[model samples]
Structure formats: C-alpha cells, structure tokens
Target: MKNEEKTKKRKAKRKLSTGLYKLAFFYAVLLLIIGFTLGVVYDSFISKGMEDEINKIIELSTTSEILYASGEEFCTIFPRTMKEIEEQTWKLGVMIDELESKNRIGEDLKLKYFDLQVRDFFLVKKASKECRINPLIIMYFYTNNLVECEECYEQGFELAIARNSLLEKVPIKIYAFEGKTSHSVVNYFKEKYNISSYPSLVFIYLEDGEERWLKEEGLINSNQILEKALTFQNASS
Candidate 1:
C-alpha cells in the first residue's frame, strides 16, 4: 500500500510539471505574436510618415523649378526698352480686364500672369533708380493660403507710375513669395511688423534695419500705396 501511494504521488508530480511546461510554452508563443504585430504597426506608421515628408519636398522642388523656368522664359522674351515694357503692360492689363470680365482667368492662369508681370515689368528694368518705388507696388494673388503671384502690373499700377516719376531715387529690392515654401519669409515679415493682410507691403531699409508696413485698407488706391512707399523710404533714409 505504501509503494502504491508513492507511485501515485510521483505520477501526480510528473503531470503537474508537464502542465506547467505547456502553459509557459503557450505564453511564450503568445508574447512573440503580440511583439510581431506591434512591430508591423510601428513600421507602417514610420513608412507613411517618411512618404509624406518626401512628397512635400517634391512639391516644393517642383514649385521652385516652375518659378525659375518662368523667370528664364521671361528674360528670354522680355523687351529691351522701357517703351516696349510699357506697351506690353498696357496689353496685359487689357487682357487681364477682359479675362476678369469673362471670368476666364483660372487660378493657374492668374498665378502664371502674376509671375510674368513680376519678371517682365519689375525685374527686367535695368535702371535701378527708376525701379526704386516699384517695390512698393506689388500685385499679389493669393492661393493655397499663401501669396501665389506678386506683380506690380495690376494692383500697384499707380504706385509703379509714381515710382517711375521720381528721378535719382534710392534702389529698392523686391522679394517675391509663392507657395508654402514662402511662408517662412512672409511670416517673418508679418511677425516683425505685425501685418495682418495677404498682400501687405512692407518697405524695408537695410541701412537702418527699419521696416514700415502698409495695411490692406491703405492699399485700395494706387496713390495711397505710393505715399506709403515714399513715407517708408523717407523714414528709412
């Protein structure tokens, strides 16, 4: 009877050990599966993030390429004389007015014309002093929550004329901003001067590091725009 009892106890002990081993094995497999699943999820998330960043980079590169290409084209076909620029400006205005009347200027077309005006009318002018006041009269086309086009042809028509009227004026540099890539520069100016408009003009003097902002209300008239530019110029000087 004693031997039988011992045999029974030994069998029970062996069974308990085997059961514990099986349980541990099952849990190990479960833990491995869970880890693998988590790894897959994390990898997918990382890959998607990387892809989004790459797409943004590509879009910015394309925008810059378009601007550069457009500038080159403008330089190639630009008129050699101020008289020719004036003639082209008049023609462009007529076309733009007609387009606006007919609602034919799509967003893309507006952006293109805006860039064209900047390159042809503003940058192409050789006379630095004559171009001084032109910087104050920028035409901005807002798109994608940013300024897509900036030309002195439409919105700054009078300002351009005023700047051209003055002789021996100080040279002013105009910086064009487009797309989200230009947001940094725009925000910098806006923050610096507390600007609150899309096409706001800020006259900057590098000599004294002074900046004057022209608000949206003042930009309604060409004369007012020119006055603001002149004021900024005088203050900076």
Candidate 2:
C-alpha cells in the first residue's frame, strides 16, 4: 500500500506544474474570450448591415407612381429597379453564405429575410404583369425542423446550381421560404400549397399570356428544377 501510494504521488507530481497549468489555462481562456469577443463584434456588425439592407429593399417598393406610368420614359424605371433588385439579391446571398459558414443562419432573422424576398418577388411580378413582360419565378418551401427536413440543405445547394445555370440563359427570380414559419403570409402559402413535407416547390410564370402556378413536392435536384422551369416557361421540348 505504501509503494502504491508512492507511485500515485509520483504520477501526480509528473503532471504539469501548478504555475504552468494555470498559465496554460489562462491562455486557453484568453483565446476563448478573444474568439467570443470577435464573434460578438461580427454579429453586431452583420445584424446592423442586414437591417439597413432590408430597410432599403423595403423602401424600393414605394417607387413613385410616375415611374410605373404607361410611358416609355416612365417604364424604364422597371428594368432599372429590377436590376437593382438583382444586385441586392447577390449582396444578400453573400451575407447569407457568411452566416451559414459561421453556423449562424439564425431562425427569425433568416426567415424574415426570406419573407422580404417573397415580398420583392411579388413587386417584381406585379410590375412585370403591368409592363407585359414575362416573369419566371419559383417559390421554394422548406422547414428548419431538423426531424422533418433532412434534405433541405441539399435542396438549397441544388437550387443554387439551378439558379446559376438558368440565370446564364434567362431572367428568373427564385424565392425560398420557411413554409412552416409562424408568419401569416408564409403560413398561408404552406396551407395553400398543402405543404406536408420538406422541400416543396412552386413555379409561377406567364404562359400564353396567362399566369400559371404549379407545385411540386419532395426533394428535387437541379436538373429537375431546370427541366420543370424550362417546361413551365414553354421553352422545353
């Protein structure tokens, strides 16, 4: 028993020295503190920037009636505003990617952003209809429910591919939303489309001068999106 106790004491003594242990611990804590501090700073900056961006986008919906008047000079604003919207889309996309990389694609903020995108889609569609311009749009519905939406991430990735591919050839607007969100507008769409599962899609476009809205459920790949989009757009053989 004395030998065993002696060995245990020796092993304990072999561990890091008290001062060294404390110093190492202090360094570790210091690093963690620095990391957390930087994270907070980044979050605050991003949140403020995003709030400003959203407010700007919302302000866009209030363009003067003169801009929408049925005059060639007046109607020029549509294309300009659309271009601005597209630029804003790219900007928001970059911010979203940053958030996603940080594992901080936060719930309410992200959903609110998506909802704002949907509102933008509505404005664009309305303007297009008034101007007799054909507008191609897709509404992607997904849930953040971990148990329910296993493929939502894949769906989003595939969607990005399809969006990039199609944008190379045609003008299209794709809006994604958390279908099960508590927001009344999103919830209304969830009920309207009978969304029971994850990764549902709705395609809206003008066909034969008539607006067509179609729905597809389950996980869809980029190829499928391209195919359906081309078909609904009346460009597919």
Candidate 3:
C-alpha cells in the first residue's frame, strides 16, 4: 500500500512539471509573435513618414518654380505654399527628434534626412536668387543629445521670434542642423564657415553676386541680428 501511494505522488508531480513547461513555451511563442508584428508596423510607419517628407519637398520645388516663372513675389507664395513647407519642415524635425530620443533611428535614415536637408538648402538658395526677394538663411547648429552651449536654446528662441517679425519684410528661412551631423555636406559647411562651437548661426546672403555666410555666436540679440539682416538685404539689393 505504501509503495503504491509513493508511485501515485511521483506521477502527479511529473504531470504538473510537464504542464508548466508547456505553458511557458506557449507564452514565449506568443510574445515573439507580438514583437515581430509590432516591429513590422513600426518600420512601415517610419518609411511612410519619410516618403511624405520627400513628396512635400518635391511639391514645394515644383510649385515654387512655377510661381516664380509666373512673376510671383516670394511673399506672395507664402500662404499657398511656403507656409506649408515650413510647417512640414518643423514636423519632420520633431519626428526625427522623437526618434532620436527613443534611440530607434538607424544610420541610413539619418543619412537620407541629411541628404534631403542639403537638397532643401540648395532649393532655398535657388529661390533667393531667382525670386530676388529679401531672403534670410539662419543656419542653426547645436548638439541634439548634449548641451554644447548653455544659452543655445534661448538664443534660438530669440532668433525664431525675430524671424517671425521680419517674415513680411524678408522671406526668412531657418535651417536647424545638428552640429555633430555625420553628413558630408554639414562637414563641408563646418569647414567652409569655420564653425567651431555650438549654437552657431550662419547668416547667408548674396554679396557682390556671390553667396556669403556670416557667423554669429554668444548671446544673440534678435534686434541686432534683424538690423544686420536688413543691412545685408539693402546691400544685396
């Protein structure tokens, strides 16, 4: 009778152990499937976002060219086109920033984004020349994840407000770039402009039929910057 009782207990314990193993295996498989599905969805979302940005750029380029050829002023196209481009640019920046925060961005996407930015910069240059309007290019450079300058944010905010105020007088565009950008174009800009610090502002204008860049650092006074911009415009004109 004792031997039978011991045999029964051993069989029951083995059954329970087998059931637990099966449950664990089932959960592991479920979790893997969920992870894979989420990964696919997220990848698709990222690709779609990039595609939208490219499309906006293409549309902006085409529309601006058409408007210019039709004898439209730079400010005239603002409500219909330029404003949208500006908004999209801001949105793109925010999206990339969020991705950077999550550390989910890949090198390939960053390279592509940088390439797009270079193209956009050239587009702005073309617009400035062809449109023949008061064009202001503020090149804002700073570290994304690190603070290279303590006053960079304040300086940037000041410039942004200044840009808004002069939007009517001058067709101003702000191109915010990461100082530690790996893009070769940024590297070229850094070398050409002698950018050595964070929160560097490069004010570019056409001087003597040649594109010129002016760098500003330290505590930025928006009013002073605006005056210089006006002077630059007058000189160019």
Each candidate's TM vs. the true structure? 0.33, 0.79, 0.65
- Deviation (Å) of 178 in candidate 3: 1.2
Q: What lDDT does the true structure give each of the candidates? A: 0.45, 0.73, 0.72
Q: What digit string (tens of lDDT, one per residue) describes model 1 on residues 102-211?
A: 45444444344444444543343333222332233333322233133333235445444654643235433333332232344444544655654444454443224432
Candidate 2 positional error at 233, Å: 1.6
Off by over 4 Å in 3: 1-47, 62-83, 98-104, 219-221
* Candidate number with the higher TM-score (1 or 3): 3
lDDT tens digits, residue span 3-118, model 2: 99888878843455699888999999999999999988888788778867877876774562345554455455776677677668657855764575466656656766766776
Q: Rank the candidates by TM-score, best first.
A: 2, 3, 1
Look at candidate 1 and tell me the lDDT of residue 27.
100
Candidate 2 clashing pairs, residues 3+ apart or interchain: none
lDDT of 3 by residue, 1-237 (tens): 999988887884433578889999999999999998998789768867776776667677667667666766754664446556665775676566567646666666666666666766776677666656536777877665455677766776687677767777876667777777788898888888888887788889888878887898775878977898888777777
Model 1 clash tally, residue pairs: 1
What TM-score would you give candidate 1 relative to the actual structure?
Answer: 0.33
Off by over 4 Å in 2: 1-16, 64-66, 69-74, 97-108, 235-237
**Model 1 segments beyond 4 Å from truth?**
1-87, 105-108, 118-223, 235-237
Q: Among all windows of ten consecutive residues in candidate 1, which has the lowest summed lDDT? A: 137-146
